[model samples]
Structures are given as C-alpha cells and as structure tokens.
Target chain A: MHEASAATAPGRGGRDLAISVRDLVVGFGDTLVVRGLDLDVYRGEVLGFVGGSGTGKSVLTRTILGLERKRSGRIEVFGEDLDKASAADHARIERRMGVMFQQGALFSNLTVKQNIQVPMREHLRLSPRFADELAMLKLALVGLDLDAADKLPAQLSGGMIKRAALARALALDPELVFLDEPTSGLDPIGAADFDELIATLQKTLGLTVFMVTHDLDSIYAICDRVAALAEGKVIAAGPISTLLASDHPWVHAYFHGTRARRFQDVQ
Target chain B: MEIPDGPTFKSSRSRDAITFELAGRWTIGASAALEDGARAVFAEASKVRRAVLDLGAVAALDTAGAWLIDKTRRELAAAGVEARLERVRPEYGILLEEAHYRQFEAPSGKRRLYAAVLLADIGESVVSFGKDVLAGVSFLGEVVASLLGTIIAPLRFRAISLVFHIEQIGFRSVPIIGLINFLVGCIVAQQGIFQLQRFGASTFAVDLIGILVLRELGVLLTSIMIAGRSGSAVTAEIGSMKMREEIDALKVMGLRPVEVLIVPRILALVISLPLLTFIADMAALFGGLLVAWGYGGINPAAFMARLQSAIGENTFLVGIIKAPFMALVIGIIASMEGLAVAGSAESLGRRVTASVVKSIFMVIVLDGFFAVFFAGIRY
Candidate 1:
C-alpha cells in the first residue's frame, strides 16, 4: 500500500521510462474524458491499462501516441518531449513505436503482404528481395502462414486479423508497442494463446508493451504491471499484487469482485 | 540510451577454418550496414573450408537481424563451405530458428503472350456476359416465385414495404427528374426550331417536340435518371446488408429475404415507373410548349393545336408501355448485384457501379427491341 502512495509520481524506473505523461488533460467538446492524469510506462515491461467502458482508456493511449489532441499536457516518449520535438525528431520517435488498433485497420483494398510492406516502404530503403523475405519472417513471427499473405483483410477470421495487425505493428521492430483490446473478441482458448504470444514476444524482443484491455484473464495472465484508470485519472498504478492490496473502494471492489474470482482461479 | 552503431564483424582464419565475430545493433534500422557486413562475411567465408558466425557481442537483434545472419550462413553452406553459428544468445537463437533461410517461389501463373491471348480475353468476356445473363434470369425466377406466393397468400404480402419503397424510390425522385426533363425539352425544342427555320418549316418543330416527348425521349430519360439515382441507392443498401450478413441472418430466422427485401422494391418500381414517366412526359411537353411560343413565334393556341394533331393516343401509350420493362430491368440488375456482394467495401462499390451501368445499357437495349417490335406490328 505504501508503494502506491507516490505511484502517480512516475518512474520508480528513473531514467529508463519508455513513456512519461504528466498532467494530461484531454476532452471532447465540453466533457473532459481524461482530466489531470499522470502515468508512467517503464521500459521492457508489459503495462496493462484498465478502465470501465467509456472511461477513456483508449483516449489516453491515443493521446500519448499523438493520435488525439490533449487540451493541456506534457508527453515524453524515449526522453524526447512530444510537444518540443521537431518534425524530424517526431519522426524518429514515431519510427520506433507501433500501434495495433482495436480493429485491424488494415487497408481494405490491399493484400496482407502489401499491408505489411507499407511501413517498410515508407521508412526503410531495402531491396525488394530483402523486403519480401522480411515480410515473410514477420508473418511467421506472429504465427501466420505465408499463404495468408495473399489474402485480404476481409478474408481473415477475427483472430487472424488480430495476429495480422500485430504483425504489421512489429514490422519496424519497434521498441515500444501499443495494443488496444488485444483479446476482447477472441474465445477463451484463443485469448490464452494470444496472451502467451504477447508474453513471448515481449520477452524475446525486449519490447515495452502498453496494452489497453478489459479482459481480466489477460490482465492476470501477462501484464507485468496494471494501471487502473477512473474518474479521468489513474487511481492506482502498480503490479497485480499491489493493486489487489489497495483499499481504494473501486480498486478494491474491482479486483475482489465476483468477476475477480477469475483472478482467483488464475492465481 | 544512444543509438547503437551498425553491425561490424571481426574475423580470424587459420588454415581452412575461420571465425567471424559479429557486433552492433543488426536491427532493421541498420539494415544497409547489415547487408554490407553479410556480403563481407560471404566473401571471406567462401575461401575457407569451415566457417563459424559468432554473435556473442551483438547489442540488439530482431527478426530482420536474425534473417540476415541466417541468410549469410545458408549462402556459405550453399557454396560448399561447412558453416555454423557460435555463441548466439538463446533469444537470438530462437529468432534465427524461426526465420531460417528458405526460398519463396513466386506463383507460376505467367504464360507467354500471344495473339491467342487477345482471343482468350474476348472469350472470357463473352463467357462472363453469358454468366451475368444466367444469373439475372435465375434471380428473376426467384423473385417471380416469391411474387406468386405473395399473390396466392395475399395475407403475407408486404404492402407497407412496397409503399415505403415507393416513397424512397419514386416520390423522392420527382423534383430532379421533372427539372431535368423540362431543361432537356427546352434544349431539344430550341435546336429543332433553329434547324427547321432555315428550311422554312419552323412550325414543324412543334410536331417533333410533341412526338418525341410523348413517345421515346421522356420515358428513356426518366428511366436512365432513376437508374443512376434510386437504382444505385437500392443496390448500395442491399449490398451493405449482404456484406454484414444481415441477409443470411434473415434466412436463418426462416424468413425469405427475397420476399422481404427484393419483391417489395421491385413491385414498387413496377408501380412507380409509369407514374414517373407520365410526370416526365407532361413536364417535357410543358417545357416544349413554352419554347415554341417564345422562340419559334408560335402562339399558345397554334402550338397546342399542332401538338394535339401530331401525337396520337397510341404515341403516348407506346412510351408508357416501355416504363414497366425498364423498371423491371433496373430492379432485377440492382437486386442481383446486391445479392452478389462479397465481404468488402470495395465489392459494394463495384456492385453498385455495375448495377447502374448495366441497368442503363439494358434499358436502352430493351427500348430498341420494343421499337423494332412496334414497327413490325405497325402500332
């Protein structure tokens, strides 16, 4: 419990922070979705971001990725202040980061192979032979067959879309990855397989993963640290054990509720 | 942390044996350097009988890094040099094993070009055209069966659906259709007057406008306009519904989507096209009359007398007779395209385009056939 008292101050990791957001105020129209929020995502750890529906879990993630505007805030990725970054600096920071949107968001007209090559073509100048082989290597890393490369996104099943999206996100070998609701629509077995895959990738690639999720099983399975967002702010940020020990009414209730029995089963 | 430098290697050789020590990021960002280094390794390893790739000093590794290293190793082995990896981190080892060197053969669909290819293309287009006709006929049979079933069990007929679609397809189309027909009528009358006046037969322009407006142009224009507007709308709606599996959802619930979706729309078209054609005819005649009085110096009464004498009752009936068939062609084509929608937004767009273009072409073709039939019967 004492560890959470100053948790919002960020960075028990000190100089190793992958993402540091301070006093972030994000809103749409008159309604403030994320108000006065502060959070930290340290390097080389899987941070699971959880919030109730419409609580702006996605908004905050999008804000950090610069996909959404913030009314007032300071955001830093890999020690480069987002607001202060020059265009070139921003591109530099962006090239090392990847995002897998909630829906696959693959180009509807492109085959999966072309979809994977889009970012590679943008940022790297590789011979087409090397590019093709690299794309196949990525496809295999995410457990997709090379045959699926010629198919369009519409031809893929829901679970395959997730995997393909993940493959595209990893196309650049990004050090930091944002995954939004990675296991929401997947069946239980599929979700478990996905959780294991994420765990393996995070470990082997040394990737810093920031996942926004409502899947309790995913939270229990792979998240190295869990951040609970409520009231337009992060109420608690720590490991699963630390969150379970907190006495805040919502945090206590959410982690110990009937649904949390699954957490119990996980333990 | 500072950006790591590109991959570099230190190699040592002693009598038929060589060790290449690799270092640096070896990530995709350093791909160019990695390629040069791999080339350097291959050039050195070919002269030796045995080769070893040591990765103990590498700072970072990704699939691309692993792949490049594995490629060099395979290139050496293929050149008859015994090669293997050494001191690789377990994670890099797994990455290497996963992205092991393999050849991806391009599909063998490329055939040599020939004049026969042109003939083949023509044959394919003809076959596809035949398939489209067959598909349309089958779709027509299904709708007819549903229409008959509804007729036999009148209690199950969807009257409200028919009326609702009539409003969407016909009532909403009136303003644009009327305005365009009026403008077209004015243009045709002005052109007729200009051409005929040079021949000292300017008053004959009145008869031309009367017969053309009453018999052919009015209904054809109305049908073409509707095909672009409401026909496209119907195809888009049904195509999107099919994309989302809503059509299949209705079938699983034991409801015939053809009865619920296609029949009412087609019936509404059948009921609405003639009424719209009548509107188009009157609007165009009014426009032609105004032009005749203003531009051709024909008084209102003179123009009215000439128009009444030039157009017969059969002339009006002949134009209205084509309306229902035009409606059927548009409805059948639009509905068939909608049902054929596969699971993509691009497919929906393509189906809507095909619906509009095919229906308009078929409308013109059907009108030509009717013209030939009426001429044969001397109607």
Candidate 2:
C-alpha cells in the first residue's frame, strides 16, 4: 500500500496539484455550514475527509464543484479559480471531474447501461456504437456484466448500485473524482473490496480522489492523507498516521478511540 | 316491532333475501364474510323479483363496506333482480345518500353543452402531437448513439444513461394527478352548490353536477390537476437530477440532456396526461355524486338518470377532446421548469411549485377560451 501511494504522488509522478482549496466558507441562509476550510489535493492522491455528521464535508465538496454558493473562498481546480470562472470555464472544469453520490443516486428510471452511457453522450461527439462500447468498458471496469447494465437502479442491489454509480463517475475518465461516502452502508467485506477497487483504480488511472467518509477502514486502506472536520472547522489535517497520533481530543477520539479500536480489530 | 330472527343461510330454499345482522362496527375485517353473504344472497335471489337488504343493525360502514354493497347491488341487477334497502339504519342511510343513491336520473340539454367543451380539448392534443413529433425528429438517433457509446468507451457511459431519464420525469407521476383530480372535484361541487342554491334552482344541482362533471369540470379539472401534479413532479425530478451533477456527468461524456432526459419525459407526460384526465373525469364525477347525495338530498339513481339526460354523448366527447390539449400544457410547462431548475434542492422545490401553479393557471385560462369559443358557435 505504501509503495502504491508513493507511485501515485504528484511529485513522484511529475504531475501538478489537481485541486487547491483555501479559506473556503459555505453558508446556508444565515447559518454557516463550512467555515474557513483549507485543503490541497495533489494529482493521483486519495484524500479522505473524516468528520461527524453536519460538519459540512459534503457542503465543502459541493462548493468546490460550484453546486453550492460559497460565502467566501478560493477553489482552484487545475490552477483555475472556479469561483470566478465563466459558465464555459466551469463546464470545461466539470468535464475533467466525476462525482459519485453517497446514495449511489443512480437515475431510478434509467437502466444501468443507460446510466453508464449518460456522461459519454453528454460531453462527447461520439457515435452510437462508440458510446455503447464506452459504456460497456466502464461497466466491465466496475466488475459488472453487460446484463446488469440493462436493469434499472431499483432492480440493482445496494452494492451493485454503488458499483454502477462508480462506473458512471469513471465514465468521463476524469482526472479528479469526488466520492461522498463511497463505502457507506456496505458490509465490511464489500467496503474492503471497494477500498481495493479505489486503490487499484487510483494507481492504474492516476486519478485524484477526494472522498468524504467516516469509515476508518477506508481511510487506512486507501487514503494517503486524512482531514478531520468538526463544528464547521478543520480540526486536523495531514497524513493519516500524523493525524492519528495527534493530541487533539477530537482527532484522538476519531482515530484511536473505541470506534477506531474496533475498526482496527477488524483487520 | 321486534322483527323475528331467522336462520342465516348461504343458500336458502326461499328466494335469496337474507341480510347479515351487523351489530358491531362494519369494517374491513368483515370483508370475507360480506363477500360470502353477498354471494349467498345472489344465489338465493335467482327466482326473486327483488332482494331486500336489511342494514338496520349495521352500526357503522366505511368506504369498503359501501363499495361491497354497491358491488352486491350491481351483481343482483345483472341477474335481472332489483335490490331494495329494507330497514336501513340511519347512518347507513346517510352513507347511501352521500353516495348519490337519490340523484340517479337521465341527463339534460345543459349537459350537452358541457360535452361540447370536452370535444374542444382535441385541438390542444393536435398541437402537442406536432410538438412531440418535432422533438422526436430533432433529437432522433443522437440519443441512441450517445447511449450506445457509453457501452464501449471507458468514460463515455455517463452520456448513454441520460436517454432513459425521461421516464422518471414523466411516466411515474400519476399519483399527483389522481390527488389533484380528487381535490378539484370537491371544490367544483362545493362551489356549484353555492351558485345553484342562490337562484332557488336546487334541483338543478343534479343537472349542474352532471354537466359540469362530465363536460367542463371533469376535463377542465383533470387537465389543471395534471398540469400541477405531473407537471411539477416532472420539473422537480429532472431539476434535481440536474443539480446532483447527473446532468453534468452526461454532458461531460457528450450526451444531450435535452434529447436524453427532457424529450422522453415530455413525450410520456404528453401521452399520459389525456389518459390521466379521463380517469380524473371519472373521479370528479364520482366526487360530485358524493357531494350531491350528501348535501343536495339527491339519490344516486335519480342523480345518474339526470346526469345521463343532461350530459349527452357530445359532452363526454368534448371533455375527452380537451384532455390532449391539457396534456400539452402540462408537458410543456413541466419540461420548461425542469430545464430551468438550478443546481440545488431549493431550486427543485421552487420550480416544481411554479410548474404546478403555472400549468394549472394556464389550463384554467385555456378552459375559459374554449368556453367562450364554444358558446359563440352554432353547434
């Protein structure tokens, strides 16, 4: 795992940082959800965000994607400040990034095949045959068969839905991927398998992953760095080992507390 | 006088004229027993001219019980036997009266005018059909090709998935339509009663209910309801999908959200709204019947008879004609609102509300136009 992490690091690979977020604050109405959060995502690195519920991990991610309005912030993706980017520039940035929602959020009415093909059809000028081939490739990458592609989201199991959503996220061959609770609700084995898949994909595709999750197992297995958030603040941020050994009460409780101890025991 | 207790038989030697002495609350728990009792009564009344239903001991009856009785009566009538209420309890009598038992009568000439309004709905349908055809031709193979490409390329599947999004936006929105139709029926009956009673033409309530329900209220109400319910649902569903990065995913993979998601929902809503309106019309009429029998002292039979006499075949045809046009308005409004949905849940809610209100308002306005246009015509 260490060797795999070293191989994908931006400096080692001679690639530039993929995302740089500085002093980002997001609020809803008059209430702030994300306050003064700063983070950096290097190319091909899996950056995991661990926080209690309502700490604005999702809000921060959405702000980066321009889906949520930022009260104040500087978010640069591929060296472009997305906050001030034009509609066309935003679209260009979006073309290079893919997102997988926590719920899988698969289009309920669409069949799996259609769901996989949606991105390809939207951004590219590909022919029908070419699009089908692209969709099939992505499905295969997620270890899903062509038969699964024809089934609707309602028909797929929870695990399969997540896999399908992953297939969709990878459909654009994005340089950066945002996954909100990618291993959430999955059993330990499924989550482990997902972790392995993410690790393998990150190495093979050289994709930068920004994941928000509370799953300690995922952080240990796939994440190169971890960021802890609490009460609308980044309480700690650094390499997983560094944050785990930190003296901060919240960090210690989150990373070395009873829950973490239990997670460690599972391995 | 205390009626002598007789033996309860599934099939008796005498003509089938037996009643279950329901002493407790009449609820769904007795459904099986009620079915058995109805079957027994039907079998025994084979040679009888009329079957008497005694409900004096029935303490309470709900919609299920009422439906059971209605079903039993219909079955008895099918066998050329009349079913009469004998010693009906006050509550059951009220329930029966509420169901329009006293308002059954043939329709009148005013009902024909209502039918003409329904016929006018067809004009709107033709316009929608043209729009759908145009949309279909414009998008055509591009949608199919985009979906196909997702199967082959590593990152192209996002585009392909968008083609099927239209079904979510359009096809599964019937519940909203049904709900709106039910409410519209209640409001129309309530308002109609108020207007008719002012002129001391209370009996004409039957004629008004029939004509309005069959021709004007049924079609008009249904169209407006669909516009609000399905239209708003469609808009919100698509808009939220857009906000969730799902639309962007498709675009990044080179798929047209308009061709893939918007078109199919538009088509589905356009096709489904008219059919939904037909169902809505029936529901509204049923609602009117309930209101009429409950407050207007009209029996279901006389009410139906007056409805038949007052509402000619043309009124029904006219109502049907309006359905497609109503469908078009709903489809267009919903799709437009959906496309306009910004990337947020709040936007989804706002757009959905706007879509429903706008579509219903437009449908009502269009209904007025049809009324005036038909009023001026010789037909």
Q: Who wins the TM-score comparison?
A: 1
Write down the worst ten-residue block by lDDT for model 2 chain B. B98-107
Q: Model 1, A42-129: lDDT tens per residue? A: 8899999998889899999989988899999888898778999999999989989999999988998888888898999998878888
DockQ of each: 0.57, 0.01
Please, what are the lDDT tens digits per residue for candidate 2 over residues A14-38?
4466887777788988899988776
Q: What does the lDDT read for residue B75 in candidate 1? A: 86
lDDT of 2 by residue, B1-379 (tens): 1122221332223444544343443433343454455456667665676776666666555433444465567777888887766677665655444332121222133555766777777877788758855653444344445445545663634333433433443345456656666666667766777788899776677677666766787677667655655677778777888778888898998867765676555556556656766777777777777777787766789778878788787777767777767766676667767776875455688889878887787788878887787678732
> Candidate 1 clashing pairs?
none
Q: Cα lDDT for residue A37, model 2? A: 73
lDDT of 1 by residue, B121-142 (tens): 9999999999999998999999
Chain A structural similarity (TM-score) per candidate? 0.95, 0.91
